[model samples]
Structure formats: structure tokens, C-alpha cells
Target chain A: MPGYRSEHIVSSYEEELTQIAQHISRMGGLAEQAVASAVQALLKLDHDLAKQVVAGDKALDALHRGLDEMAVSIIARRQPMASDLRMIVTSIHIASDLERVGDMAKQVARRALQIEGLSLNPRFYNGVKHLSDLILRQLKGALDAYATRNAAEAIAICNGDDEVDALHTSLFRELLTYMMEDPRTISQCTNLLFCAKSLERVGDHATNIAEAAYYLETGKQLSGDVEELQRVQHKI
Target chain B: MPGYRSEHIVSSYEEELTQIAQHISRMGGLAEQAVASAVQALLKLDHDLAKQVVAGDKALDALHRGLDEMAVSIIARRQPMASDLRMIVTSIHIASDLERVGDMAKQVARRALQIEGLSLNPRFYNGVKHLSDLILRQLKGALDAYATRNAAEAIAICNGDDEVDALHTSLFRELLTYMMEDPRTISQCTNLLFCAKSLERVGDHATNIAEAAYYLETGKQLSGDVEELQRVQHKI
Candidate 1:
């Protein structure tokens, strides 16, 4: 009878864990859509779509709050130990990262709204679009790695941050050159610069999630190679 | 004898709580010094100080990790509930914010290094200097509020973020005009623009810590007023 009772308790605990994981996956989906919509809004200069992206961030925030509350409540009730505790804590971390990703998307959308009707250089917009696509891929990869507990994939996504940083530097230089060549392009180029920055930050948040996934799987931090990348990126 | 034993346990628990609070305070002090030093480096073009700020960020990161580990360990071992759990969780949040504050300082320092020989406009430098001063004040106030568990002071700090936003907008406009007026200033002005942005982000982190402080005290999130302020700031 005791064995059966323990099994029942374990099954309930697993159910709660599954629920939290589902919430994180749902939140990730919303963040992905937010980024996609915001970038499309920027590229098309669609004020309405940008507005939608801004509105969509609230849902992501709500989901994050709900997920955090659930995770904390489970911790308080279950008093999970070792790996279970790490998973719960890391869920909170991932939710926070996803929420910030949503905020970055909103930032990009706001920039789009601000620069509405200003014809920017197509090359600059194309560069930012390409960067956003790459970040979105990283975001998805990180989330998938989390779902599958694939630390190798998570580390790969984390390492991919160097590419984003490189692209951001190039975009920054290109924009500065454009503004120097045509002073009239200063305002629009500045807006694009911020857009690129938002995309770069999205990459950072994706990397953060990748790190969280690695920690969740191994119960250890991925420090060495990632710290080296950060040092190199910091020089600029 | 039993009463004495329980009282001793309570005291030990309180001691653990105090230790976590002390770590947070130490981290906050370091972050404040970092921003101040980084800005001074930028103003004086002091390369050594800039490098110091960059190197000092690792200490802040270590403190953040230690605090988080302590907090999570307490949660798992002690299984704190209600306000105690909230306090522990919020400490982790605040530590994360302070660590990011260090990163922003590092970013400002890197910009200082990149524009080492260029002479930027005095007016623009003064504007950035003034903004940094305000943000540092806010950082101090937020930390003080957290130490005291004073929700009122925290809300005040949170409300102060609007001023930083307004100043950032103006500084951004001024820098853009400077770059447009003199193509030769583009590189320097771009660096200054990032400095302003880093300072502005520091303000956001302060506001985040303030919000965490309020939540720790009240066990409730201060969402309504802060969100309203964010909306007003975003309209710009």
C-alpha cells in the first residue's frame, strides 16, 4: 500500500512538472510570434502590425507571471530536491528570458512606429531582417533544446551568439557610413541602429535560455567557452 | 529546553536571511561604483579606469551567482513559505538586475576606450554626465529602499525612471544632430550614443530592482503604475 501511495505522489509531481514545461513552451511560441510580427512590421513599415506586436507583449507578460507563480508554488509545496529543484528554478529563469524577448520585440515595433513613412536604405533594412531571422532561429533552437533536454544543442545555440554580435558590429558600421555619406539619413539610420540593437539583444536572451537549458540538463553552468565569447564581444 | 531549541533555529534562519541581504547590499555598492567609474572614464578618456570597470564586472557576476545559489539552497532546504519565500526569490531577481547593471557599465567603458583620442562636443558629454548622475542616484535610492524594506521609497525610485527616459531621448537627438553636422564626428558620436543608452538601461535596472523591493515588502507586484509610466515613455 505504501509503494502504491508513493507512486501516486510521484505521478502527481510529474504532472505539475509537465504543466510548467508546457507553459514555458507556450510562452516561447508567443515570443517567437512577437519577434516575427515586430520584424515584419519594421520591414513593411506596417504601423498596425507593429501596434499588434506591442499589444501582444502583454499576453507574454501574463504567461510569464503565471508560469513563475506555478513554479514557485510547486517548489514551496513539493520542496523538490536536486535535479527537480534545478528544473523548477530554471523554469522561472527561462520564463523571465522569454518575457524579456517579448519586450525586445516590442522595442523593435516601437522603433518601427517612430520611423514610419521614412524611406530608409533597403540594404540597411535587409541587414536587420537577416539578423532577426537568425535570432529567431536561435530562439527556436534553444527552446527545442530545452524541451528535449539536449545540452549539446543548447551549447551550440549559445555559441551561435558570436555570429549575432559580428552581424551587429557590421550593421552598426554600415549605418554610420551611410549617415556620414548622407547627413539626411541620420535620423532614419539611428532608428535602424536601435532596431539592430534590439535584434542583437534578442540574440543575447536566446543565448541566456540556451545556458538555462544546459544547466537544467546537467545541473552545472556552462562557463568556459561562453565566457570567452563574451570577453571577445565585450571588447567592442 | 524545547523552546530554546526552536528559538535557536529561528535565529539561525534569520541569520541566513541577513547574510543574503548583506550580499545584495555589497553587490549594489559594487554596481554603483562601477557606473560612476565607467562614466568618469568616459568623461576623462581614462583607458586604465575603463579596463578596470570591465574587469570588475566579473566580481559582480560571481556575487550574483553566489547569492542565487544561497537563495535557492535555502528554498530547497528550509522550504520557506509566504513572505520569506518572496523575499528569497526577489533577492535573486535584484541580484540579476545588479549584475546587468555591471554589464552596462562595462559597455560604457568599452565605448570610452573606442573613442579614446576623439574630442566630442562638451555639451553632449555634459548631458551624458548629468544623466549618469541621475541614474546613480536612483540606483542608490533603490538599494537603500531594499535594505530598509521601504516600499514607498522603492515606488519613488521606480517613478524616477521617466526622467531618465526623457533625458535619454534628448541626448539621442542632440548626438544625432552632432553627427549630421560633422561627418568626422560620426564615430565619436556613435560611441556617445551607446554610452547614453547604457546609462538609460542602468536606470531601467534600478527601476526593476525597485519593483522587486516593493514586491518583497508587500508580497504584491507593482504593475499598474509602472506599466503606465512605461507606456508614456514608449510614446516618445
Candidate 2:
């Protein structure tokens, strides 16, 4: 019976890993949709789309919970080791980052709803739209890198976050300048500032996922000093 | 020999759990220190202390790595199930949040160094100082709740985050209003906005830790819908 149980666990190990990967893909797709819809909602002040983005977070949360359960169950049941364990561990971190990305998008969508009734210059959003576009690309790249196990692309996403940060800082000043120049626009610009912040955080989450992917593929941290740790993992 | 091996694994299980708990405490302590020192550095514009806060993040990072290694090793070697496994898993998450708290404080300290050359009225920091005070208390409460396994306190910490969120928004407006009133104050207010934002994020991270703590202690999510899942864990 003990031998049979061990074999049974081994038989399903690859299936479980594949299921986790597929779940990650689905979650990434959902997260990307949330961020994309949030941008469209903000740009068009589309009430229905904003509502959908806000409501969509529940699905992402459910998926996050599912992924956590799957990871924990596999680890506890199969007791996978070395690379398998690292993959499961990294997946948990990546899923956590993706969940936060959903949260950021939800915040942005809420702000869009907040400023829905206001009449604003489209020019007001060009900077924000630009930031969102860059973040969306970064997010997409990160997801692709994770799926394909492209450590180079993952590293690129991490490095590209600085551009996102610089853009955000500049946009911060631009939004505040609008408030300063036209006191009438203060409320709108304040909401816009928060939206910009949400977008910036999405970029941060993307970087986190990329870093996690990088660690998964390389057994090394993007920030270094992980070589020794990998040795320990192997020894254990 | 196989029986001897099983006995050895069981013997070290408690020690491994204790080590993880102790590691979490140390990481939490360093996180609190980083936040406290960052506040002091910002209030006094003390460059040395700001540098110290920035440098302190490395130690927190090291401890996070150590905790992860310990958790992974125990799980792979001992293959602990049930509550022992949950404790190890929760410790990893708590350490991650604590590490992020350190990162937030480091950011605030960096802002302190950025604005070190500016001469300004200390009154400008009154709102910021108050916000930091609230955030520090929340972070400390969260750590203590986790240490004591007080799920009620953890839930209270989660509820208290709304106050922190509201305070951050008000401070955001307050700082922007200062900029509008005097364009000359824009740069200073901008930095203050970022520092305030960092403090707000610290509050958010505290809530995350509190939620994790709640889940670990109760085997249920603070936000509910986890009863079925605990049943699943028990079945596993």
C-alpha cells in the first residue's frame, strides 16, 4: 500500500504542475483584461466598463485562492523537491503579484467612476494613457516571459520598470500642476493622480512577477547573492 | 533504517517550526526599526539616519531569505502536514510583508535625503508626522497580533486600515492644497506626497500581514468564505 501510494503521487505530479501552469495563464489573462479595461474606462468614462472592472476583481480573487490551494495541496501531498518545489514556490509569489495587479486595476477603475460626471479635456489623460500603455506592455511582457520561461525577457521587464517609474514621477508633477493652475480642476486631478498611482503600482507588480520568474528559471535572484542559497536548496 | 529516518524527521519538526517563528519575530523587529528610524530621519532631516535606514533593508532581505530557506527545508525534509505545514507557509508570507514594510520605510528615508537641502517650516510635516504615527502603530499592532496569535486583534488591524486610507487621502489633498496656495512649495509638497504615500502603503502591508495572521490562526479568511476550504485541508 505504501509503494502504491508513492507511485500514485508520482503519477499525478506532472499533471498537477501542468494544471498550475494553465491556471497561471488564465489568471494572467484575467489580470491583463482588468488593467486594459480599466484604462479604457478611464479614458472614455464608460460607466458599464468601470463597473465590470470593479466586479471582475472577485474572479481574480477566487482564482488566486484556487491557485494557493493547488500549490499547497501539491506540496503537502506530493512533497515535491528541488526544481519542482521552486516552481511551486515561485508560482505562489507570481500569483500573489498578479492578484495585486488586479487590485491596482480595480482602484484605477474606481477612480474612473469617481470622475465620471466631470467634463475634462482629453489632453488631461494623454500622459496617463501613455503610462497605462507602457505598464500594459510591461505586464504583457512579464506574463509572456513567465509562460515561455524566457529569463532574458523577464529581466528586461524588470529593467524597464525604471522607465515606468520616471514617467510616473513626471506625470505626478503634471497632474499636480494642473490642479495648481486651475483650482477648478483640483478634484478631477486628484482622482487622476490616484489613477496614475494605481498604474505605477501595476508596473511594480509586473516587475515583481518578472523577478519571480527570473528566480524560477535561474535559481538566482535578479538582485543577486542567491548563488549560495541555490547550493543550500540542492543540498537539502 | 526507514523507521529511524521517520523518527529523525519528527524530532526536528518542532525545532524547525520554532526557528521559523523566531525568524519572523526578528524580521518584524527590523521592519519596525526601519519605519521608526525613517520617521526620525525625515522629521529631523538627518542624513546619517536616513542612510542607516536605507542600509538596514539588506538585513531584512537576508532574514527573509533565511526564513524561506528554513521553510522550504523543513517541508522537503520533514514533510510536515496539517497545522505544522500551515505555520511554515504563513511564516513565509509574514516575512514577505515585513520585508515590504522595510522597503516602504527605505523609500521614505530616501525622500528624506532628497529634501535634506531644503529649508522649510517644521509645521509642514505635522500632517505627515501624524500619518506616520498611525501607520507605525498599525504595523506594530499587526506584528504583535501575529506573534501572540490573536485573531481578534488581527481583524481589528484590518478594520483600522480604512482610517489609514482616509487619512492618506486627506493628507494627499492637504499637500496638494499647499502647492496650489503657493507654487513655490510644489517641490517640497511633491516629496511630502510621496512620503505620505509610502506611509499609506506601509499601512496596507500591515493589513496584509494581519489578514495572513487571521487566516493562519483561524484556518479561515478574515473576509469569510473559507470554511469549505478548511474542510478541504482536513480531507487532504
Highest lDDT scorer: 1
Model 1: how far residue B182 lies from native, Å = 1.2
In model 1, the clashing pairs are none
lDDT of 1 at A43: 90
Interface RMSD for candidate number 1?
1.1
lDDT of 2: 0.84
Q: Tens digits of per-residue lDDT for model 1 on A22-134? A: 99999999999999999999998899999999998999999987987797788888888867888888888889899999999999999989885766568877888889889
Report the error of model 1 at residue A193, Å.
Answer: 0.5
Query: How does residue B90 of candidate 1 score in lDDT?
Result: 81
Compared with the real two-chain complex, what DockQ does model 1 have? 0.70
Task: Give the candidate number with the greatest TM-score.
Answer: 1
lDDT of 1: 0.88
